[model samples]
Target: MEISLNSSSNETTLLADDCWEFIFKIIISDDSCYFKSLSLVSKQFLSITNRLLFSLTISTLTPQPLLPSLFQRFTYLTSLNLTRFHGDLNKLLCQISCFPLNITSLNLSAKFTKSTIPFVGLLSFSKKITTLTSLTYSNIYSIHYTDFIFIADCFPLLEELYLINNLCGSYDNFEVDFSDSFTLYKLRKVRLKRQSINDELLFHLFKNCKHLEEAVILGCDGITDDGIASAISQRPTLKSLSLSDTFGLFSNITTHFIDSLVSLPLTKLILINCCKYSYAGIICLLSKCRQSLQHLNLLNADFLSDQHVVEFSLLLRNLVFINLIGCKMLTESALFALVRNCASLSEIKIEIIWRKSVQNPDSLMGFGVYPQLKSLYFAKSVENPDSLLDFGVYPQLKYLYFANNRWLSDESIIKFASIFHNLQVLDLSNCVRISDEISKLEVLNLSETEVDDETLNVISRNCCGLLQLKLNFCNNITEKGVNRVIENCTQLRKISLQFCDKVHNNVVDSMLNSRPSLRKIIAPHGLDLCDKKKKLFLSQGCILK
Candidate 1:
């Protein structure tokens, strides 16, 4: 079970096949496409990769007759996705039911066609595979209200269900009939999006499910705040609730609903594009769930101001993740207040505001280091680049996304990179002013920036451990600069050069010949390879896109 790998020093290192499998599992968990390269390592790796295949996505390209062989080859598949299969779903389900596979999760989201759920086929499939516990049917053209009753009967033990139907012309006329004989007693989480889910259906779900814990209702305008309060009052086990794009909620209505949920120990609440709620309503909810809440997302809530965030910051001491995206009224003061109060906060996302008046010189200065913080996302434009210097370093920060920050300069970039020693992923896409060299990073994105040949040389020298580099719109980088990166960065696996006109098709061959670790190359425009040439690259374990 142990394999020996000879290092460059002629030293033999013995590793168990189980350890290699575990490492491959981690890589595939991040991206499944890496399996192709991993399998090509050795026969031992090929066997390990086969066993690691626990989930498979069956699309239109998948041959119907090859299902049995695929299942036999990888006998541990427990999750199946048929969202893009354009053929007869009924027959496909019946065909798959014959296999002795222990599939627990199934996704039938029809993204290509406007097909309805194959109730007959699903009933047959459920009969064969009683181990199924999760079902998803998103982006389907239409589904009747009565279909829920059939789904309850088909998959009685389903723990999670996602039904995202598209807006149809006859959605308003859908029936609201529920049978008392059928109940989803085991259903714990349900997400209904862009459907005609009215108050009656919502209450029926809460009343029947009994143990329902999380409910996400997005773009459903038929349910009012009163209905939500009444339905949620019935389910004491409900801990997470998400409502998005709901126009029926007002200031008073929202406050009333929040008051009704005071008895429940809610842990997570998300309200997106529901801007009618007053600050008092949000504060009331936050205060009620202050002891238990851990995650809060209020996206596109235009009513949120700095005062609102500051007032609620104290209640969010236990909050781990908070997203305030699209709340245009909030300033840097709101962000600093959360960092000061929320001791356990790990991730923070907020839009940078552009104000005409000059900011206070001491606004962004002197916030103590927060070791718990790991990721930060700042969208839109940053008016003052100098303020970034004052934001202190976070030693544990790994992922930093400052995409679309037009005013971000080299001085701020160098200062920020020097502080976060463990920074692994740095995304400065569309920050056109970033032309300086950064420190060693695993994944770096400089797409749409002014990164030139000199900067690439510097990065190749410093970031030799780079795995993925994206330079899509870096027009100043030519073939010589790219060749230097390919030669120096021996661990580079993926590189993108989509719009660099100076880089031609000849560099593709050089990349394939020079670097055996290269797996994916997004070539520039007007570089179309023939089928034979593409196969040649694939033979060398490189995919040309």
Candidate 2:
């Protein structure tokens, strides 16, 4: 694809190098004003937009010669993000010693305080990024253990490592000797948050990164349970293991970590809100990863009951995204045995904390409309909840989080929003007897519901494909139901109206002059609107907090 014509301008053509590298990978932008307006369109579009400006983000309120003129006009940067860099660490290590050391993903973050410790010379410039491979240093103000062993001996072809929530140095009376842990044998994905990571330096950094594949240990309180079952039995290419909120070490070793993942063949296992584990070791780790489990998050597991989540909804059945959120002794026959046996379930998050339905949600009738269910939250039921009104026509239910169902009335939420038909994010927050129908919803949360103004003029005459509307404390809305939802949703961009104190300030200046494509309005502090209407709400680009 070579198209060259530009005989010194006039007919201006020239686009080739693989169509400017596929338009710089489809215009990936960190807003350098779209490559400074296509690099003033010429000199071969400023040398292929400076080789697609391969990622650069220096922030600390920029403009200190904008980080040495963006590394002297982008010489093929390979990802660099020094965001929140709170100034002068020897002028950001003399502008990161004129970077371009072929940076292969380096994100050094910083904000300040904790006695500011922006120790640049990161391992004395790790021989200028010897082809560094992914390093995300987070929330830095302090970090030691020989700066985490000279940034893990300056990335030996490092393969992904994110150390979040920095701050850690005082090795009180010196202890951190994890027998030479700095190993990065081509590391394979490791995310350790809230550091000071222990367990003998996280099992001596996973016994020298034996090709560890995806291990995210959040809130690492020096991980226990035999240092995570000896680093999950030496990662045989460990497949996605996210141990979240890690103190309570998998609720006191859920049956020896499900007998150390009887031969890790895991396909995404996230133990969220990790505490109180072991419902027969989570139904024997879902009967040994029921044929390679597909994303299962026991969110707030509350010791899953109802005959062990109805025998883990008939043995996983190759489950696909199951988040038993706050499992309050799950019933309705364990969500009709997981919508009649997983069946490639797309996404299901439970929680109807009692209120009847030990079974009879029409006795788990025949299972018809699941067909790869598409997101269903259904939380809180406070009695007489008519167990999901005889679930059937799911038709790829598109994001439905029936929040605080207070006896979901209104003809059972318009017969469950009339059988899906491609609904889009309908979160009836605090469902005060669910009002009006969901006309092709597009992110409607009805905050503390019982919507008024005739459900905002029936969501501006049938949800005109609404875009982000919350109505914070629905104090029976005012301002003429937010000017009939900013004059008929007209593609509204964001509205919360917290504590709707009968909204004043001329209904927030006529809903920012009838939504000039509203961008954000949260309200609540009694619409005080002054300082020339908050600089005319930031001069119309909107954002009346």
Candidate 3:
């Protein structure tokens, strides 16, 4: 039997509304700018994009009378950011409370401005919205100890709290009261920055908030190791702790503090600028939590040496991510030890500076391949130009940040392309000698490099899948090179051309017109585009910065 298909009916039958909505959601997940482009397709798409917006940021510049219409249009918003709203915050909060919205996360962090917490408005808002679980109130001019108690009372269901005040020496005069009334039973994560919190406040929190898990305290000089140990001893649920920049002549992470941490099952530990610490104390702490700790960051720990790294790396078998940014004493030996021991390690950020001349740097090479390693931020300086050649290939590595290496050249780029075949993101900023070829990268940053038109042409030919390209301060490249990249890299979404002297306004206009996929363009300073042109670019779903 022969069957004849009706082509006309097949062509006319469209996808269901639900199926289109699902497809739009997946597309926006990768690039939200697609929502703007999709909204222009038809009225159905416009409605769908409006419904998909789950978050909105409102600044003080936004008219108060238009908020109701804006809120009504984006009814699915569950997160509201009011960090830029510097007007009468109390009145704004009362206005938001009247809206029929279920906002779960609210950010009132006045990062660019200084404002006190709107206690009166927050109390009224809390009564209407009990679903808020996260609150971030940072960069306030001043906050009394009573403000924290008031916050706990207002949001009893808050699971995460970030309270950061501007450290201006005003906290010393305020009196703090540690009472049972300050209760946050549901609080699980708390970050206090530049606050004058003492042991009594720490004890009150640990005692009242029974389920606390993560705590980050930075620049709080009043917190002592003994106070932390005593408080942590009672809380077994604590998994992550970060302490940084505790200012005092005698304040530092001592053996006693390390010993206290050994009993807790911490998965993440970050200690930055904790000037005085014993090598033996750190070793003991690592040995105790070897099986549990997965993330460790020891920034500005200049005392760390090659011997110390070799000894402690053995205890980091299950470590996944580690940052040793400012440990100047560490050499290539530390990197070798970590790769040899930590089989599950994926990401590492370290600075390796070779102080002495080596007869044969190849002798420091280690054994085996680490396919699990994907991201590496290695900023190094070595006397030997062939130092990078000794390092073996990372077959599965995708993200590499080898910035500020003056010795990097064409040979190193070629080696990288051959070794990291799956590499997608590469940052070689501040490497003056590199004017070479690269592999098929998604994101490439060659800022402050010596790349010219010839080099860019070679890159545009190879990197067809490039999404973002940053060429800031690359004065050699002209409009010819940039236009080639814009024409060839069809999937390009963002490009930065700040301080490129040879690329003028005509090039910028051509870039906007040529690539329909371009969402953002960081043009050179003083391009002088008119308001009409800017509106036209916005209409075409491209932003000029």
TM-score of each: 0.91, 0.33, 0.92
Summing lDDT over every window of 10 consecutive residues in candidate 2, give the lowest-scoring window: 166-175
What are the candidates' C-alpha RMSDs? Answer: 3.2, 20.6, 4.1
Best by TM-score, which number? 3
RMSD of 1: 3.2
- Which candidate wins on lDDT? 1
Can you rank all candidates by lDDT, best first? 1, 3, 2
lDDT of 2 by residue, 1-545 (tens): 12344567745454576777585566534534345445555677777778777787777777776766677778788887875666655456545665655888877666464532344555545555577788887775445456656666666788998877755533222367745457788889888776666666666677778888788887666567667877787675688888876455544665566777756888888888877666777777778878887888888878777678777778888888888878777755576678677788778777745534354556545544565677766666446555555666766677777777677777777777777777888788888876665566778898888778877888888887687898888877777877887898887768888887765546767776776666677876566756787667666566677
Off by over 4 Å in 1: 1-31, 41-43, 166-170, 246-255, 352-364
Q: Which lDDT values do the candidates have, in the order given?
A: 0.82, 0.70, 0.82
Regions of candidate 2 where Cα sits further than 4 Å from its true position: 1-148, 152-202, 206-229, 232-282, 285-308, 311-332, 336-456, 460-467, 470-484, 487-512, 515-538, 541-545
